[model samples]
Target chain A: MKDQNGFDELARQKLAERDFTFDPSHWTAMEGLLARPGRKRGAWWPWLAAGVLLVGGATIWITAREHDPAASVTNPGGGPRAIAGEVKGVNGSAAITEMENASYGNDHPGTMNADPAVPVTGETRATAGTMRGETSGEPRMRTEATRTRKEHGTGTSDRGTVTMQVNKIPVSSISVRQGEDPHAANVRTGEATNDVSSTMTGPGAAAVAGDGASDERSNLATGAVDPVRSDASAAPAGGGTHGEEQPDSVLQHQPPSAGTGPVVVAGSGDSASTGATAAPAPVDPVAAALVPPAWLAITAPYELTLLGGAFSTTGRYTGVDAESWPARTERQWTTDFGLEAVRNFGRHFAVGTGVHFSSYKERLITDEVSRTEQQLSTSYFWVAHDTMVTIVVGDTAINGATYHMTQLVPMTINELGVDTDTAYQTMVIRQRRSALNTVSYVELPLLLDAHTARGRWVFGLRGGPSVGLLTGRSGSLPDNSGEGYHTLNEVAFRELTVGWTARAYVRYRLSAGWSVGVEPTMRGQLFNSLRNADLDRRASAMGMMLSLSYRIQPTPQP
Target chain B: MINDHIIAGCVRQEPKAQYELYRALYPMMMAICTRYERDRQEAAATMNQGFLKILDNIGTRRKEVPVEPWARRIMINTVIDAHRRNKERKAMEGADIDDHAEGTSGINDYLKDMEAEAFAELLHRVPAMSRTVFNLYAIDGFSHAEIAGMLGLSEGTTKWHVSHARTVLRNAIAAEAMARTEKTVSR
Candidate 1:
């Protein structure tokens, strides 16, 4: 106790002793570690924000592109709205200029519609006719499906009103404003039946008024007459007299191409002015198929992924028990490859199936030792007449006294107690023996996956059971000490194994269709790898898997 | 000065607060470094290396524990690393233990008579391995088993080094006292 106390006290005194004054210069050297160039701590949030913004912008661009085709079909002008107003001036040619000014703008001058009442003829007129099914050869059955909407104006009284018809069929009510130009008072109402007068106001009225041009085209084909000529002839008639007499005059003046149907022309210029009419042509069939189907409106939600990585068993053989020691188990890296197809039910949940090919290896190493020994046995010899003679050691015992000879005569005893021998030998040997076990398997996995996208990254979890069949198995026993180690086969481990696998992943979207991801998976076989063993030893594998996924969308319906 | 806030500032590697922390813990850490390093310059280098490690890994420190002990642990580990690097180079040098006979002087008497700097001079007389082992095992509150693992030596070897360090220091102190008394008598 005294020695221990003395030593402790002396050690404490020695350690407590030092010159501890501070030097200001030492600070420079220590601070150099923090100031090393290019060693700045990187902040990840800014990069993450930039990536999110980039991905968001790309998504918006892609969505806009998908809707671009349908947009062009409806709005041919590329402007906000289409205006189809027409006004006839002093001459028939001046009528186009007046109509352009009234519909578009005063400054908007155009010669595209020089003859405003010339039936937008040929292909456009024929297509419009076939759209409503009202051509010469076709039946009037398309009229029953057409629903006309009525438009009411500020004035309810029928003043200079003209009842217009197209393709010899009636649609719905059309009312003109009393103070407005009756020549350019052509207003078309769609199936919505909402009053168009509220929308028809100011310079923009022509813009909003053209919104229902589709319905007007259908109505134009319903009357079985020349639509533009009827509208033009109706432009000048102001009174009931012109309204009553215009149909007869227009019917007499119209050519055979304009059909023999009754036409009504009303305007404020004179009693009844008949306009020129163009003939309708045959409808085109190719244009009918260009209409897109309802099913092609949405994007597809299936994903295909290719997975490749390495996996290893998280198992070690500790020689059966803690005390029973022999060798160590070392496992090699195994290759894993898979192809997965997932069908997404929604944004968050999906079901998937995949085929996987994988292989694993393990080696058991043991230390070798050896042993050796020696032994001796007795023999009998006889001499006769100075000549040596040999005899069998057990012959005299079986014959009793038959081989006995006195004096110099040869005698041999089979039971003779004889010689002893000993040998000294030293041996030193140490060797290492190893056993290798390899297995390859094919598995089919059915899994339910769930995922969510945040900015450019997608986080997901997928897990399910797989039916694994052992395709190949090979094993080698320790060569020198072969008795200590035994070979193994697929039957030793079950040929068919049912195992569960689960993985969590983070994927970065590379493009709209392609994404790259890394997933860490944990898998374990339910059945034991070794049979007839007291302790259950199941092989479990855990590793990080890298994958590239491609999204496959459904083709646009014809 | 060595509170949670200064620890946090050091974790962020802010120079102003790191300077404050350095000035606060300078004396004690210098004492630790000086015991392990023979030269004052080498001790400064070791202490700075230890401080750099503390700042670099300060963010990982547990919040419940005081920062001083964690910093001290880094300092001790740094000193051990220095000892290991110099072990083979200094193995040939041996202590001259026959310079003084054993004397019955108490540790208290030596402390009362000598200043800390004077005691440090006597500690230099002990060999390097013995000195480091004593500092780590006795003063640093490290167990013989832990010191063995840290220095990669057997527990018995660490115990022997501690005993040998004590014997060398005691003899050196006794020899210094004898010389002083003789000089006073001659005067």
Candidate 2:
């Protein structure tokens, strides 16, 4: 026994002092198990968000154009209409006087006089004397004629007495002799009809006449006598007993009058007529060309924007040992997209609020222990010995010694049992792996934007407080033991977080109502992501944002 | 020997520190694992598993305790765990006690002259369970009662396994010594 003990002691001593050969590949294998693959999967989220915004903007533009009622009226060719030459009667003295005569003759035919030298003075007029004139040895008689006999309750007269006014200036009655040449009268009537038709059918005459008549006419012909006479002659020559009503029919096609122009009243005399009416105003083509289309005249104060951006996310860690946790977190790309509605206070400052979906991602490398189960099959042999009893026939003839009919004999037997048993065992392995921690939130941000515009470009700075509600969370964190990681659910995470966002933006106007902008933004969290966590972590991101905006003009009041 | 700086670096999981620590402890860890495993590949695999456990739990280790002893204890426990997982009962081989008694004194002399590798090779000839029990009781300084609990056997059974392992190893060493002596005589 002592010799065996001595041998055991010697063996322990020798083995304890001995060193064995080691292969360096063992560490290599361990390192391979520890390494985690780089996270490149989420880098495309920002690009996808930008694409969605672009597509949505284009769809809205196309739909607006298709549904706009004024598109056909203002832009029949599906392109921008010219504003200069298209707006007639804006600068021409003759054009304004002709338009006014046509408008007054068509609307109130009771106030029209057959003599071209006298104009309608008031809403109602009474003519009591006939006027005679001789031109080229032809005697012409002027009379009062109601174009619509039912409207004015008066019949057409060739020689009855009539009273009239010239361009709102009352004048004495002038009579023309009877028996005038019909061919010369018809020739004068044709020239007057052509002049009225050309003035009424001019480009933008309908639009200008509707609103421009009241305002623009104030700066137009105040007392243009010749153009007024020509236009007035067409009224009687076209709607008189000769059955020439072509000029009146053409004037009826003009757009309805928005309002009446100013009327100047003067005493009943030739001197009073020329004295009360002032000289014609000068033409201003620049002022005439500056008029915007009816659709663009109203200002829109509300803007809707679709914004998308990608950010490089990082975290600041405090309140714990840096070595126990991750020394440095890897920055990852994440994305956000949402809609915003802004009310412009003026051209420079605006307040905006909206809903957004934003996600923050961080990568942490941690060492963890994992267990795997394996099944093992083992085969073995079992040996046993047993006693067996058997009956043997004895020689019955042996004797009368006993009536032994049968005798029992004992025998030895060997038994062998071979079987296979299945069992399971767990193998534990530790590895270093990267955990991509992603926390998503639905955010509501209130931002104040200040901007200055030049031509088609706008430069601005926007900043605001943002509140976020936790929507989804995933990832792993180092456990209390620092030996392995636990799922993110095991940690106490904040259900709500507050943050600040700041950005500088540059926007380019694509059209009158549409614009596209690019902004460089920075967002930071004010509190830790997890409550009572070992590490106090605040996440922040820097990113570039793309936005598409549209101005929503209010409907014009009737 | 591991220093405080190395421990601190390992706790931080620095790759350079981990590699240094691994190289420093490789020889000792391999020596312990090879004693219980069948070959170098199995030993290497088992040593790495124990090393991972060491790295994982190094931060929790008490600073007052020496690192080498603590690491050695973990490696020893890991080897025992592996032995229990693959435990199988093999038919016991009877040693020729009559010849063994005459060669006992010569075997003891030969054991003192044998290298650790040769001694380990001879010990590997013993059955798996007996070899594990013998290693725990003899070289590792574990009590027979502790071996029984670790291997899930009774104290008597553990004692029998250790005796059987010693018998086998003694016979093997005797045979090898006789062969060497015969070669010397022939030469």
Candidate 3:
């Protein structure tokens, strides 16, 4: 037995010295496990960056489109062409007539400034003039003109040789007066019929009579120009000889309706008769570029929203032996914040995507079996015997048996000692403990919303899937043995979880570009929170959300 | 030996330092795990789990104490935790009986020399409980009382298991010796 023990010692020494071959594969596996927690913590960064880049790219594209000159010109019915017609007239000839009429000396007949040596009959006039008119009561016509110059026909006039270029005129120079009959004013000035004849003979007269009538009417409705004042100003300047000859010649070609109210012409002067002999007034390209395209007024708007809310959170558990642990989870509060960007498709529909952070918290109470080690002392009585011997020395020699004698005696002994044994007792404790579990996640939501506006109020419904990356966890849960609680921080939760969110919101527009809203929301997870766990836990929250939204208006790119 | 810098780096979860520590501790951790586990793959897995715990708690380690022993203690605890988790399944399978029956035979050929590898093979021949108890009490320098507390057994039971493990190893060594002698005589 001794030799065997020695050999056992030898064997133990050898076993202690044992070393298995090192396999790099094991380290590879370990490295992966080590990186897992860190990877999960940083998983949301890429998603966040992607969302920022998407929003940034969208902003750049929208702004780029807003400032692009080519973009404005892409629309055929509006933009620069419309601006030109708005400020000047259909063609240069009409602008010349407006300039010539506007430049007429109002009270001086000889100061008419008609250059007869240059023959205003069949020659182009480069004229820049400004006209300002005000009427008293109802909607009145207002005509704006820049300075007029005869580039090729610079002959001496009574007012001296008038030749100058007017690069730009301020928009403030235009004004509309209310309550004035343009034809009555023209007739009161005694230039009604001749003014009509001059305007009809201009270059764009046919177009003004046809497709350009609405443009002319729109301009008139807005009191952009007043032909009555133009004719009144022109009558004293050249209405005597020039107007009489032009009226007779031009009236021969009048469309019968010319009799009714001076034809409501766009321009009125003798210089306007030669339709092909006028140069368009020079306009500031910068001002023309300021007018937004017609399409932009109806273009979809983008909304950026910052939202926050509190929710009632609940967790539903399922799977293996799930019912055995009947953990009653108390409804708790969940809080969330998000930044969202929505691109409106039109007035009624929008699509949004954003990043959010949410914390889910719950208190769970359940039955657990607790084991404790206790020491117990066990005592018993036992009888112990001791033999006693007695000797008689002197008288033993004479009587052989009487000289010495030995006697035996028995005694009972009792003692106490400490017990080194340990005993474990299992107790079922019911509802005596509760654990608070909290999990935080970074979520990216993609939503589609449909909304309608009524007065200052807007109502909408938004719903979609949100993908979440678990960022952190805390607290505890029942262990698999139901013997105690295990710290949830050590639990392997799923790194990524998908969920669905739906909300209905009512918002009140605070201004042209800002709104505030209240939304009632519900969100629920679609997958288990724990990875490879027997228990399937899905969390859900119902909350009221308050949101502040700003409509991102497309600004002119500087 | 792992230095303080390596330990601090591990606490910071630096991958290079982690790999360095893993390399330094692999031989010791694997030896301990394989003594308790029969399969090499399972032993490696258990070692990794223990290493992870060591890395996680390395910052809390007493600077005065050497790192190897501290890491070994954590590795042992991890093995015990894994044992407790799988205990019910092991009990249901009645694996202890099969292990004992298989441990007693056909192990002499592996005991040609009492080298560490051969000794490890011999140790695996012992029954699971007896082997684990023996490893803890003998090689790991755990007292019978400590082994009893760890395995939830009486001290006497722990002693019995140790004695049983020694007997098994002793018999296998004797068998190998006799086989050697017989071969010599035939030659």
Candidate 4:
């Protein structure tokens, strides 16, 4: 219990001493941080996640369209353009059989042969499942069907036509064979809007004969042949031009809209030619060389700033051994303003300097002793009975009288031992006195600065030595004690003193080229304010500064 | 300014009132901060941050209760935060527990006239954990269980830390007293 009580008392006594003094600049710096706009540090992540999701969705959607063949053929408001036919020998003959509306199969958009020979103009054909196969240029017997739905008779259409080249050797051109006029069906879609030709460019019959000779020979003997074997590669090359056979679903051309720019379809060799020219546009070397980097284009090199703030003077006794003292410093409200210009070398670093006009007033409380002289006076009641005195009662002086007279003598004596009836009075005297010291320094500082910036935030550290050329000095003691206020002579303070100034600050950009910031600064004199004062006694200034800055745009490179 | 008025103003977040309260309470808070952080600059920073916290959470303080303990708790929390931030550095500087203990002086009279600053300086010599335990248990009137919960330690470990801190402080204080005595005798 004794230990606990001791600890409690110790803690209380120790913790209660509030004499701790901090560097005023540090407090100002903290104030600057507190006064800054609140940070939105935690808010950026959700937006970043949303952006990732959007990009991922777009990527997946693009990939799906590139591989889905049926999706390519089935245009909006138009049914699939299927071509149904049965091809046989000279005796059996081939014919267009059926047509029907159908959705694309929910599988890899590969080629398919329709259910055996339905009427082409009628709507009775079956929707066929997609058939997967390798590329084989061979004769095989099968019935195929197609359905075509024509909606908009005038605008754009998904009227796709398949042309099977059935020459004995490598067929270079696959012409569309019309139902009635096979010769006229070879027209390109660009020449006739009604004609839709999917050009499959490859060496055809030779590949089939080498790879499927047995199958071809058997079908040839049977005197019936499916002209187009359902090879996956036999699928229309929607717009592919780079050796690889592409699925037909990816659009070779964008649908036309009244107000839209001409659509540039990627991977379409013909569209690229038609869209611009078969030849590349001429490049201008000088213009290309003149382009500036994106970041530099938005940055300015020179910046100017204006700052204004309040400052307080902080001072401590130079080397007081004991923590108790008459040594202290008090401050008056001081204001400062500055103008600075900075030259930024790049995004990360800059150098600058500024001129500041400031005033500092502080009362230095010191003990001074002085003394004066005065005439001493004393008054006391001294009673005496003279050798030949008549005793007289009641405050009467008896000089030379008989005892029947009864006289009494009483007197007051001065410090010089003079007898008097009155109480003594002291003369006016001059005396020593100690008075509180008041001092002020008006300073004009020129300081160098350096700083860096990231995104919207900037941090800077600046400092340099400056001289305090004291423009004026004034002092007076508190009134009513000895005399009213008395102004001291100029010799009491130094004419000039050297000091260093430093500050660190953070700023945030409020808009283009304009920013607001707070700076915490420390300024101190190397020597004491008084001419022959103690070496440890000097004036220190700490302040919080608010500033506005504007970046000047650099002229564009010639 | 009256303490209650300062509390009311701080709760309202009036900057002038807040600054007034800061000036009023700064010394005691600085004492705690300096004790926790030997570096004067860091101690100042810690004290500023603690004041910020007090102002930020002033609404939670009950009316008519003493403000010192509440402010002290916040300052301690700030100290703990600072400690956690520099835990690795402290550990590197040998703040961790070790089995070896220094011999105690067993002299309690030395504490009778010890200056507050001197006592604090002596307390700084104790290992961080023991010093914290001693402060909480002996001075702040926290139970071992509370110290254990606060420091994430067991009750037994907390008890050991208090004992260790007392022994270290007693020895250091006693040694200081003996040195002063010898210096006086020589003089």
Position B15, candidate 2: lDDT: 62
DockQ of each: 0.19, 0.18, 0.20, 0.11
**Tens-digit lDDT track of model 1 for B1-187:** 5766567656656565587789888887888888787788889899998888887788888898777887888898998998899997545444665535554546447655677677776666678888888778767878889999999999999899887877777777777777888999999
Off by over 4 Å in 4: A1-26, A39-558, B2-14, B59-67, B92-106
- For each candidate, what TM-score against the reference? 0.35, 0.33, 0.33, 0.31
* Error in Å for residue A109 of model 4: 55
Model 2's TM-score against the true structure: 0.33
- The reply for model 2, stretches above 4 Å from the true place, is A1-5, A36-558, B89-103
Instruction: Report the number of the highest-TM-score candidate.
Output: 1
Q: Is candidate 3 or candidate 4 better by DockQ?
A: 3
- Model 1 regions lying over 4 Å from their true place: A1-3, A10-19, A42-558, B92-103, B106-108
Q: Where does the lowest 10-residue lDDT sum fall in candidate 3 chain B?
A: B93-102
Write candidate 4's Cα lDDT for A451-540 as tens digits. Answer: 544445566666677776666545543222333333545335677777877776678776657889998776778876654333344666
- Candidate 1 positional error at A347, Å: 25
The DockQ score of candidate 4 comes to 0.11
Q: How would the docking of model 2 be graded?
A: incorrect
| Model 2 lDDT, residue A296, Cα | 32
DockQ of 2: 0.18
Q: Is candidate 1 or candidate 3 better by TM-score?
A: 1
